[model samples]
Target: MEFTETLLPGVGVRYDGQSRDGQPIAIVVAHDGDVEIVTYQRTDPDAVQYRLELAAHAALAVAELLGSPRVSARLVDLTREIPGLHTRRLVVAPGSRYAGRLLGDSKARTRTGCSIVAVVRGPDVIAAPAPDFTLLAGDTLIAIGSERGLEALAELLGLTPDDPVPVMTAPV
Candidate 1:
């Protein structure tokens, strides 16, 4: 549909969590990157959903429209979505060999979709660290990537997504 999905600066806002029934609701983002929730008495939320579907139908009616998602060569070539594309955090122990394994074995990140953005060691911080940067004890790794990527890192780092990091002293 010639959707400008590459419009990297776009944003989406919605109410989520177990509190909501998992309905797809739409919210607005201002030109300044602020999120505004969609509420009642303003635009009919249900009607808005219907209108979006109708717009999709109209788009489908176009003879030249392509419904399938296609990856752009530039996106794949640059891997623009891998670096600062998304972010997650990992608090590793003061010292661990996992640091070597992560940067040494990038395929795990490539496959799972996570990239180490930076490492916070105590009061000092290193941003855009090289792949060879060795991790020290009490190092906080700032990572970014897809959900699966985050999960893979968690597994390798031996911590749950929300668990407090314990000292990794179990002999590597």
Candidate 2:
């Protein structure tokens, strides 16, 4: 589906699109993290059907439920916005060496030139985790760097380079 973005100037940005079923929908993202989801009546395009508003934090919780694919999609969009940079999700397995080790122990950033921007542990997201933070099994590390750096980081984490890592960018 295609979406049209309209800048609200003093407010925020609005994205207008049609749902797969041909329902008119508009998503407005405010500067302060408020989100408004508006749907229009099918019979009367200009008439309102219903509107749902979500606070920033709430929207994030919803996003988590929607899973990492959506996040990856956004990351793919990010890759398009910035040339050459890439993002990938690395899952820490139960048998991995870094399963119970500190973040600094892997020296991931220094060794692979990739920064672990966030760690998704279950329902919680640890943003910009410090080196002292302990990594647990099942923790999904969100890292950003050059593609080769990402591959190196995966290797450093004891994970095979081809093990389900969602490459954020297509082959160029």
Candidate 3:
């Protein structure tokens, strides 16, 4: 979930990170508005495994498909209506203990008192996912709970507050 971003001077920005499967990946945003998603081999970091090129419009479409805006709006509205309620996005990263495990195995709700309302994987959103649902690497969990509970859930997912991973939450 943590990535390093480097400014490319006259170009744009380059984000480097490791994939959920331990493969190196780089995302480059060009000044011309194009985006490239590249994956490298585990053995050779510089060797290209595959590359996906997206135009500005295509990138926006992909973002919409991921439902960031819609989900954020709904979470914001819910938080605004309730006191001490918050929402956060928790990513299942590589090496996570829960990766490839069942949602019920984590006992997230029983342990942290946080409800995982949705699971966003690639272009698919599994709303109200069952406890039997399997969690895969790269899956983004949309959880709603108190701040303390959410922080606990993050720790359960092997993330600390100091991690660079973005914990997007609605304004209290």
C-alpha lDDT score of every prediction, in listed order: 0.47, 0.79, 0.80
Candidate 3 C-alpha RMSD relative to the actual structure: 10.0
| Tens-digit per-residue lDDT, 1-172, candidate 3 | 6778888998887889988888779988776658899998768867878999999778767767766534644675689689899998899987777789899977888778899999989777888999999999889999999898898888888743345543343322
- Which prediction has more favorable TM-score, 1 or 2? 2
Q: Over the full model, what C-alpha lDDT does candidate 2 score relative to the true structure?
A: 0.79
Per-model TM against the reference: 0.39, 0.54, 0.55
How much RMSD separates candidate 2 from the native structure?
Answer: 8.7
Could you tell me how far off, in angstroms, the CA of residue 113 lies in candidate 1 after the best superposition? Answer: 1.9
Candidate 1 vs. true structure, TM-score: 0.39
Candidate 1 clashing pairs?
93-138, 94-136, 94-137, 94-138, 95-137
Q: Tell me how far the alpha carbon of residue 169 in candidate 2 is from the true structure, in angstroms, after superposition.
A: 23
Instruction: Kindly give the number of clashing pairs for every candidate.
Output: 5, 0, 0
- Candidate 2, residue 37: the lDDT equals 89
Q: Which 10 consecutive positions of candidate 1 have the poorest summed lDDT?
A: 68-77
Ranking by TM-score: 3, 2, 1
Models, CA RMSD each? 14.0, 8.7, 10.0
